[model samples]
Target: MHHTIEVEDLYFTYPDGREALRGVNLTVPPGVKMTLVGPNGAGKSTLMLHLNGILRGEGRVRVAGMEMNEENLPRIRAAVGMVFQNPDDQLFSLTVFDDVAFGPLHMGLPEADVLLRVETALRAVGMSEYRNRVSHHLSMGEKKRIAIATVLSMHPEILVLDEPSAGLDPRARRMLINLLKGLDMTMLISSHDMPLVAELAEQTAIMDNGQVVACGPTAQLLADHALLERHGLAP
Candidate 1:
């Protein structure tokens, strides 16, 4: 019964002396899709950054049975794939194929293996036809899918997404939701989209003022309108 992720009394502060995370504690079991919901500045992104050692704070953070530290960073990062809110931030290569192949290539995988990973990842995201296309020229939705494929090519066991559905149109959002539902890895998604959260996550954790304030079943938490309103999730 090993947990996929664990955080204990995590605390972090920015260089400017602003505290981003305040003694946060969280745990995600393997194969669970959990949504992290909170008002702006609640430290959701900050917390997600710690999952793979992007932001090392004062606390214990573990992923895939490895502790968060400089020595374990490479392994931890390989195990935890992070997809940022903006697809542009994740996509930098010339073509979609290059962008998706970047991680596997960096891992020093063989040429054939990298090619296979790129193809498999693109097919998973329904972007196989866009492999040769320019990454910057695609639509937001297409770019988002490619961004996800970039991480998928790494063969991560856990997926951490930050505001994945932001700026998506109805159709794009729906498509993203479907794509996420199809991914079998453990996921911790940070988003304000309640409906998307409801559709994808079985468990939900609400963050506020740099800490997790509530956590429970998605249906149970979403049903508490007063709690949602208090956290700025509902009007």
Candidate 2:
């Protein structure tokens, strides 16, 4: 299998002396949909950052067959599109169209190609009509959709999202799930919502104290009440 993502004994420590990731190892093969669930401070964010070369650490981290290093960062980031936990961080342009077009534009796409990518991305996220809307004025769910569109325009091989449905209502959350399901790229999602995880991911991994304690089929992990409760994922 072509593993789009791979990490072997990955470890990270904050400047303040906190070890956020400890000997973490994970693999997301092509076309796999994996969800990561864990208690707060379990290094979920740290690990996700490493995937796109946003944060470098000890050991091996590879995205789209390229090692996570200064030299490979640019290509790795292009291959792995990351939608942050905070939509505000991802959506900075004044207009939704601008925000969605940001990546493609930076990649030096022509004006026509950039606009086409923006439109296609918005359509994929069900936000086509809101392209000209002011990004800051949009609702939380709308902002989330636009943030996703921003990454989708890059045509990444793998989509990585952190807390995707964090603040959405049930109806909006369901719609987001459907939107994500329609995408063909491999996905790496970190979320506290068990139901969303169960529905979106074919594989699930439980993290605790900076380590992935368990990983298996989503159905089996979701059904193990005792295991989840132990890891603070009880639903």
> Best by lDDT, which number?
1
Model 1 pairs in collision: none
Please, what are the lDDT tens digits per residue for candidate 2 over residues 1-235?
5699998998899999999999998988799899999999999999999888778889998889888888988888889899998899988888998899889999998999998999899989999999899999998899999999999999999999999999998888989999888898899999998889988999988889988899899999889999989988885
Off by over 4 Å in 2: none
Model 1, span 1-235: residue lDDT tens: 6799999999999999999999999999899999999999999999998898778899999999898988999899999989999999999999999999899999999999999999999999999999999999999999999999999999999999999999999999999999999988899999999899999999999999999899989999999999999998972
How high a TM-score does candidate 2 get? 0.97
Residue 24 CA displacement from its true place in model 1, Å: 0.4
RMSD of each: 0.9, 1.0
